[model samples]
Target: MEYNEFITHVQTLTQSDSREEAERATLAILKTINELVPDEEMQEIAVQLPQKLGEILREKETKSNQSFNLQEFIERASQKENIKPTTTAIHARAVFSVLQSSITPDVFTKFHKYFSHDYEELFFTSP
Candidate 1:
């Protein structure tokens, strides 16, 4: 999807009042993923997304840090998105939902494999 369409979907899914809010939330999740997944794996997923989103995923240069769990993931994203921890999961679901729909199944699978079973909960929540 194009960047605008991607952001619009995020906004619609999260019911954010402004595109900017959705964009920030989306980037927060993407950036978190960038930090969690290895650079090569992240690059694989990034190329499949819109240019802007891809760039966001590639913004970080460090190696992946997979030590953290789901709660820490939520906390990091909440802080980055500037949203409450209570609502971060919903926003994160919106971001991942948009990602699942936008990319090829293969690419999504590659991205999904990086997260453990616990992270699967984010996928089921209402966006």
Candidate 2:
């Protein structure tokens, strides 16, 4: 799927009243996306993924960090010609890509599926 579409998908899958549930769902999606894409592209995406995901996952804590504003960081990074805007899906794909590089593809696949399944459970179980 395209970047925007993927972000929308993640948003849908992650909708929850509880921030903890949303964060877990987002992390699951990120792990899956990381397993499915390529290395170079993953590295590019990684520049923004951790921060963006961190924001959604750690809303209050991240705010207090002073240096954890992913959106602002992305905006500044985008000012450079080489850096692309970090969309939700792009961040997911980047995470997968980085994982692919760091771990064996087989392990990544297993972990991705496991996380995806766990997120699905959380998404459904949430009130």
Candidate 2 stretches with Cα past 4 Å from truth are: 1-14, 50-127
Candidate 1 pairs with clashing backbones: none
Q: Report the poorest 10 consecutive residues by lDDT, candidate 1.
A: 60-69
- Write candidate 2's Cα lDDT for 18-83 as tens digits: 444334444554433333334433444444434554233232211222232334433433342133
Report lDDT (CA) for all predictions.
Answer: 0.85, 0.39
Give the 10-residue window scoring lowest on summed lDDT in candidate 2.
59-68
Per-residue CA lDDT of model 1 for 26-106, tens digit only, reads: 989898888798888888878888998998888884457565788999998888988898788888888889999888888
lDDT of 2 at 57: 29
Q: Write down the TM-score of every candidate.
A: 0.91, 0.31
